[model samples]
Target: MIPSVPTLHSERFRLRPLVRDDARALFPTLGDPQQCLYLTRPAFGSEEELWGWLAEPGWNGRTWIAEDGEGEVVARVVAVPTDDPEVEEIGYITCAHRQGEGIARECTAALLAYLLGEEGKREVIAEVDAENIASIRLLDRLGFHRSALHIAFEETHKGVCDVAIYTLSRER
Candidate 1:
């Protein structure tokens, strides 16, 4: 059986499935260094990779494209299931031109609400680069308290770097 798609909306943005048609709008944002500072990989070389990543199978995870009121995609948000069914990892990135507009925060909050409230997900985890203060602050505002710091969880494009893990539980 196919997993259900989630369409989440916030006051200023709409979070919908990351479709093939969004490649043109998404590539620029994913390719921008400033927008992907905390990401594990550098800019995606092709739209095919982006599409493939979104279409991959997972029971408790999904990717969403954030669009503004005028229907322009400004960012991407994702909730990926881990080995444990009760835990889901969340991450997001906004286009360079759209930073500081609260788009990431809005999209992330919507995703958290959908996962915890409707999907019954127990916990949401996020691994952010230690230097990415903006994302750290955003996660905190969304009720994700820091659970670990300066941990080497994965080998990223920037070599071995410290990351901070934050978690928001359903009980909170």
Candidate 2:
């Protein structure tokens, strides 16, 4: 069965379903070479790819478009079930222009609450590049404890960078 759609809200942002039409808004962030630093894929080439991934079935994942009070899409937060049913990894990215505004933190906290409080998920995990101090700090504020640091499995210029693993349990 398909997973239920996820919609979460915070004091300053709302997380809603990511749609194909968001490509135009997403391109600015996704297409930036600097923004793609820690990401697995370089850059999305077309809207079709975005739509196709969002529409895939049997995938236990949901991507939310993070919108500000003005209803402008500023970033995206995603949670996807891993091989272990009790664990899901989370990821988020905000527009470079909107950095330092607490957008990612707000959305991440909201998403965590929605998953653990509403959806009954057990654990939420995140892997961050060691150099991405901003992301690491955000995760820390959300109660994600560091579990490990390892070389990333994905290849990039930073081939063997330190990865900080974080986890939040449902019991918390």
lDDT of each: 0.82, 0.80
Best by lDDT: 1
- Candidate 1's residue-wise lDDT over 47-94, tens digit each? 777666556655456678899999999988888878888888988888
Pairs that collide, model 2: none
Considering every candidate listed, which one attains the maximal TM-score?
Answer: 1
Model 2 Cα lDDT, one tens digit per residue, 1-172: 4476666778888788877677777877776768878875566566666556556765677788998889888998888888887788999999778988988888888888888877788999998888888888888888889888886544666466677788899886
RMSD (CA, Å), each prediction: 2.2, 2.2
- In model 2, which runs have C-alpha deviations exceeding 4 angstroms? 45-59
lDDT of 2 at 75: 90
Ten contiguous residues with the weakest lDDT in model 2: 151-160
